[model samples]
Target: MNVEPLVPVTEQDIQRYEEDGVVCLRGMFDSDWIERMRAAIERNLANAGTLAIEYAEGKSPGRFLGDMFMWTRDEDFRAFVFDSPAARIAQKIMRSQKVNFFYDHLFVKEPGTLVPTPWHQDQPYWPVQGSQICSVWLALDRVSRESSGMEYVKGSHKWGKWYKPRGFDGKDRYPEAQGETIPDIDQDRAKYGFLNGDMEPGDCLIHQAMTIHGSGGNVTNHTRRRALATRWTGDDATYDTRPGTFQKIREPGLRTGDPMDCEMFPRIAT
Candidate 1:
């Protein structure tokens, strides 16, 4: 399988990511990567990892399932972390000399899933700190607002504010999380300049860790919304043992302020 992106990461894309904190790169991966990841998602659904969370099971209208760190145990996900174009893409967009694989997360929203993912910043929930941390969200199926396309608040990453993390249940994930409360974007959506659009299979959205984003429920009666988010950190990322931060299922074994380039968060590109 080709590991290189089908299309180059242009300067404009990098600029957009820097200025807006997110950029949609169309057709970055080919069908081969898509199919391989799709199969891997199925395997993960059947045998969920230890950290898997079925957020909507028995409580919501449809399913909103999530799991992280699959690359530690799944061969397909391991291959993606080591051999996919995601790392190079992160390196380019972040303009860093090196890139490390942070983790891989799976989000599956079965058709008619009515659980809306609450708006929040990603960094506040994780045990890491850096400006170059990002997630490459790859769509394995057609995506749109109706299918729960993720929407980002344009340029919100530059605001230098960390909103408290929220879970899929629309409740606070950490009661002790210290940060500014998220603005009621839903109440005043027009003022935030939410950026979202339709994406086809193999397309991806690369967004910085601080970007405030969320998605609606999978309202399509029959179209499933499955996505794989491969997170990568660049040269400046480091371990952070902050209070209220969620611990990784498999600890990275790095003390506070250490570079995130150990066995778990292996350096993939330099």
Candidate 2:
């Protein structure tokens, strides 16, 4: 499938992303593309036996695992990531000769679910080191501030603080050092205004790796907040696993500090 080229990211958009740590782009995908991805997600959700199943008794599959990347096993998800307009936008934002696919995550929040993602930076959770990494948060459904959509801190990416990682269900898991307070956006919601990503099907929000972001719970009935997040790093990115964390690099031909040259993380345009 040949996806059309995205409009070149303007100087203003790049500056905005750098300054605010998040930027919104509309019409990145059309209705047809949205439907294709929606169907792809449905297919993966229906076939429980296809991918690695992490089932919890007496709970829906959505509640148990929260659907990590199915692209590694599902063909439809693979096509969506490898052969879609999403990859093009990722390359444009980073302004690198090539953009490497870090990974894909599928976050599905079922209705009335109170699981909140704690305030943290994506860089801390990642196994790589670099400031070039960014995430494209494509919402497959209508997202609002009340429905626990993404909330980011404006210009927090420049803080340069190493935060602790917590469970996605909003439990603290980080060992606090002396004089270190756990990242909490809820404490001062007024000072750090919520950068609510109120997005439609074709709209997408791009954020930096160090940006402080998290979401609330899904309270509405039958509202599915499905997001396809594709992470990318610049050609100068490197792989340095954390002490206790184990990251499985799916793509081959990647060295520790080498530029991303694998096919899975392709140079879509440049």
Candidate 3:
């Protein structure tokens, strides 16, 4: 099937993204695409079944589902990522002649869930080097402040510091930080700080791998915040599984500083 071509990203959008480390594009997807993705998610939930973690206990049968990397596992998702405009946008933003797929993460936050994602940077958790990676967070639902959407620290990507990883339960697992508070700031709620991401269905926000970001717990009733995040990197990106790093398990074959040109990270655009 011939999908509509992606609209060229505007210079204004690129400028804003560079300034704030994130930019939200509204209605980037058509209604038909959104519906198709929603349906695909529903199918994945039904067939794969939901993994009930401590945080997602007592929720709907399929309130939280994730990790749909092998697009062949779901036809609709494959079409959305390949046939849709997201890949082109990612290619343009990285300012590279080519862009490759890293992975796809589906975050489904059910209503009234108190499991907040801890403040973290994707770079520290990734098994790759360089700043060529970015995540395209596309909301599958109407996301609002009440629905616990993403919040990013302004220009945090340029800080060049990779902090220790924390659990999704918001606990610092590193022994050194024991009994100490996580010093990261929630730019959304901070006084005189910047919190610049709230998106609707078909609207997506892109952020650098090093950008500090996290989300609050869902406090609203019956608000489902589902996001489809597709990670991409430039041709220069490489695989690196640092020893003693949890990220190593995700990309086992990758060695430190090795070019990330494996089939898993296929070049989608050029």
Which of the numbered candidates is closest to the native, going by highest lDDT? 1
Tens-digit lDDT string for candidate 3 (1-270):
225324457888877777777878787788888788888777766665232134455533324444446364677776766778877887777777777787777777778776666777776656677777889898889998778888887887776667766656443434332122336474435542456556778888888887778887777789888788988888678886664333221343656787777766667743
Query: For each candidate, what is the lDDT?
Result: 0.89, 0.69, 0.69
Model 3 misplacement above 4 A:
1-7, 49-55, 58-65, 68-72, 170-192, 244-252
Poorest lDDT segment (10 consecutive residues) of candidate 1 = 165-174
Clashing pairs in 3: 238-260
Residue range 92-188, candidate 1, lDDT tens digits: 9999999988888899999999878888889999888889999999999999999999999999999989887766665566787778889989999
* Model 3 TM-score on a 0 to 1 scale: 0.84
Give me the displacement of residue 213 in model 3, in angstroms. 0.8
Q: List the residue pairs that clash in candidate 1.
A: none
Model 2 residue 108 CA deviation (Å) reads 0.8
